[model samples]
Target chain A: MKKHNYSAGPCILPQEVFEKSAQAILNFNNSGLSILEISHRSKDFVAVMDEARALALELLGLEGKGYQALFLHGGASLEFLMIPYNLMKVEGKAAYLDTGTWANSAIKEAKHFGETVVVASSKAENYNHIPKGYVVPSDADYFHCTSNNTIFGTQMKEFPSLEIPMVCDMSSDIFSRTLDFSKFDLIYAGAQKNMGPAGTTLVVVKEEILGKSGRNIPNMLDYVQHIEKESMYNTPAVFPVYASLLTLQWLKNLGGIAAIEKVNEAKANLLYTEIDRNPLFKGAAVAEFRSNMNATFLLNDETHAPIFDKLWKEAGISGLPGHRSVGGYRASMYNALPLESVQVLVDVMKELESKI
Target chain B: MKKHNYSAGPCILPQEVFEKSAQAILNFNNSGLSILEISHRSKDFVAVMDEARALALELLGLEGKGYQALFLHGGASLEFLMIPYNLMKVEGKAAYLDTGTWANSAIKEAKHFGETVVVASSKAENYNHIPKGYVVPSDADYFHCTSNNTIFGTQMKEFPSLEIPMVCDMSSDIFSRTLDFSKFDLIYAGAQKNMGPAGTTLVVVKEEILGKSGRNIPNMLDYVQHIEKESMYNTPAVFPVYASLLTLQWLKNLGGIAAIEKVNEAKANLLYTEIDRNPLFKGAAVAEFRSNMNATFLLNDETHAPIFDKLWKEAGISGLPGHRSVGGYRASMYNALPLESVQVLVDVMKELESKI
Candidate 1:
């Protein structure tokens, strides 16, 4: 039975990626050795790391720009510290928009470095929408924001332009939509959502924005050192990088973000239409700021959950339960998630309405 | 042809580990979901994380000994910075034994925290032997050393008794020998050598040694935070941890380190004895401190290099070249390398002498 895995992270990837990853583990590039055993510095694996980094920049349309893409260890959580370490000056402040849980966490880590100013926050309203009219301070070292919130199913539809360096955590929505990626000085995403698996984080940083922090940054967290080493300053996450290359290759073959954006819009539209039309269900986030990658919805009455859950399980749907903080169902429609799966989920939702 | 892999660090693991890991990537535990696609918070993956952590402690005989084992990212290189951040006080010093490239790197990172004392160093001797008769400062916050030097083919046979905390970077040789594992307050190993693949790192620390640094440790670099979250403080390297679990299970089934230690010694002795008996080759490191896991050697006559390289290639050996600083050959015989592979290499060495 095929499963519609809607896991928020460490989430679904293309079937070809799983097959190729398994083959590499058994025998990498027909090299008579498992990919797991090969030296990272070897020519074969070095090519892999090189291709992964190059393809990431190519996909973002940041090629030939000042950006250097790095496949680093420690997920976006570590990036929270690295951003402050590599960007914020000694006693300087960073401006952040608090839109969701991840954005809030980033703000918390940034506060530990120096002064952190929250320009505006949607947290008081349970993060159901992207905050508007947020004024990023001009004198701040940088402005940070989360592009998509997986937990609350909200996404920033329009980013605020700033004179200061702009950084964004696109962990859930990177490569799902087309945007002028060059506008942001530093953009990072964890690989589990819409990229590959859980292990490596993709960091795209413009070279001109680094080394101005005026602090004694450690080697591992310093972006300049990683860029200098070509993401091999130390041993990188080899398997994750290889798998991500396979994914980026998959995305490129599928005609890049421009082509995938149409399909994403179709999936989101199909699911959201049912949520609004059905008397039993209602969308969780505000309609204007709803995420295309993850759709959070709640039943009008909680009593129907058992039957709805049973129907989805029978329909082979997994990871439908929302975050514990938000008690509902979340259907994550990452790039690899097919529209047919969303159709199946919509059919199940319709059936729940009919049965009730 | 079955190639004999000799790459250091990201070296060979058991064949069963490769097979099982590949199977899991395709269909994990008959769960009908690829392990790469599952959430870290899922019941299945949480079980894997628990098992891997528990088995690491169990194999090291540290169970119920106030020790906590964690799987982290950024490899041993990151642990260098983490050790200084979490152990060294704001202004106090730490003692270090400079053994090899990795140890020197650790010492470099420790210097960023406070005073770093090089108690003794074999760097003057080209790191050919572990320094002895060094005194660790009693007032230092901790003492640090590398258990085995893969690049230099040296192993510390004895560790000093310390009043302060003791930390060991056992990256290349963990789970290969039996040791008084509880003697060290903290031990970290990158999981690519004897453990599994290149993504997650294994950190085992005695609980009582933490929270004494008095520095504001970032959440990601804090061992206490990771322990409190059970290694899921952030999204862990899922595929690496699962693969490591497979390798750990294989080691346990093979009778743990005691059984593997005998085999390791036999393999090392077989190769080293032939290197000694054969006039064409000479061991690189001092006799007393030669490592059993990685045996670095050189050709006595440089003119025989072509034939020696050809013979080893014909015998299906790979990753034979030594570190660039040490121009020679290194045979890395980790826990999963079969004894028959060593026999094949020894046969090739014998063939080289006859042909010459």
Candidate 2:
């Protein structure tokens, strides 16, 4: 079966990235050492690290703008705590916009280190839309927000330009679109979604934003330490970083983020159009806030649920089942997800509607 | 040229493990989805997690005991801080045996959380031997030790049976030998040497030893939270864990820890015997404390340095250059390293001696 993977994370990657990564695993850069076994400090792997870091910055359009990119382990979840530990002051407060689960998780960790002010939240309506027009405090140490909500399929299209430093978790939607990279003091993403594999995290931080927290941050959690060491403070997630390098190279060869943004918008539109036109389905997030990366939807009637699921499964659609919390279907159309895959899902939806 | 990987780690892996891992990366379990793309929540990855956890405990002979095995990210460096964050109490003290660089790193982190006492150390001799006959303070929160020092090429041949909790960093020597598993409260190893890759860390913690720190441990660093969540407290290092599963399976098929220990010893002896016989080279660590996993040595004559380096490189030997801190050569022979590779190193050493 030709699987069209819609997994929110640990999700789809370009076929080229997969092929290259597999080849590297067998014999990394013809070094006769498996990528899985070669030392991170070795010339071949170091080149991978250097290239991955540079590409992450270059793709974000933040090259040489006093930003440093680090590829580290423990995923974006660790970043939730690390961002607060390294940025949130001991006695000061940081502002957060809670869009969904991941944003709230970041808030929960920030609260442990210092005071946290939830400037805005869409949680009241089960996070069906991105919260808007929230007052970010000028006095807060930093303002943090999640750019995309994976479960609810709501994305923050326009970021607020705040007086305080801006931090964002771009985990699910990073590289799916072009963004104003200069506005964020720090941007973190787990590589699983649009980047590469599930091990490494991409952290791009503006250099000046660190060393002001005044707390004794653990060396592992300190962004300054990691930045200074070029993400080799500890043995990094080498395989994932190498794989990420390949994916970033793929993204570059496919004409970078600008090119992918068009493809992403088209993929999202194809699925969203089917949901809107079909009588059996309803889009989950509000139209304005609908994510270009993740298009979540639901069956209009409970009776159609089983048939809808079976039809998609038979059509080789995987990971479309929405999170248990949301209780529907989520078609995550990341950057690498071709329009044809979304078309297949639309065809499945149309086929199910004909039965109805 | 065929490569002999003696990398301190990310190091050598079984060729079968590499082949299987590379195959899975391309098409996991014939599911038509790249392993890099499949959801970690999928049945395929879930089975991987389950089998990996089981195999780690089974190999350590801790199965069905109070020990809970967790595969996490951030390597042993993260464990340095996480160990203290979870085990060290605010007002209490922890006893440490400062064997080498990593042990000192762990001690450095522990001091931030609580009072840490270096019960014994061999820093005077540049960590060339493991400290002996040190009394562990009973009132300390825990007694921490490193089972193997990768940089210094020293291993703890004996562990103290202490009344207080025992925590060990077995980053370099894990799964290379059998041990009295119940003696330690926690055993953490970065899975680069003798395991799989440079990302995932294997943590086996006694269940009762947790939740006693009385500190607000970050969710990411809390072992209790990770154990409760079955190591999926967050998106784990999925690819590395999958690779580790294959390596563990390889170890089990080759008769587990006991079987590997004999092979490890033979490989160590083969290299050490050459270092002893070849007057051109001298062993770095004291004979009594020399690590069977990492055999550190130096050229008896500085004039032979360039020639010796060239000889090993030409023989396809990699990662034998000793750490800058301990200037010499380090031949790290992990579990997957065959005697043939060590023999090749021995041959290179002998050839270098003949030139002299």
What TM-scores result for chain A when each predicted structure is judged separately against the true chain A? 0.99, 0.99
For candidate 2, the lDDT comes to 0.90
Q: Which clashing pairs does model 2 show? A: none
Q: Score the docking of each candidate (DockQ).
A: 0.89, 0.85
| Candidate 2, B1-356: lDDT as tens digits | 88888989989999998999899989989998888998888899888999999889999999889899999989898988898888888788899999999899998888877789999999999999998989988999999999999999999999988889999999999899888978999999999898898889999999998999899877888898898898889888888999899999999999999999999989988888888888888999999999999999998888889898899899988888899989899999998888999999898888877888
| Candidate 1 residue pairs that clash | none
The docking quality of candidate 1, as DockQ, is 0.89
Q: What is the lDDT of residue A25 in candidate 2?
A: 85
Q: Could you list the CA RMSD of all candidates, in the order they appear?
A: 0.7, 1.0
Most accurate candidate by lDDT:
1
Native-vs-model 1 lDDT? 0.94
Docking class of 2: high
**Candidate 2 Cα misplacement greater than 4 A, ranges:** none
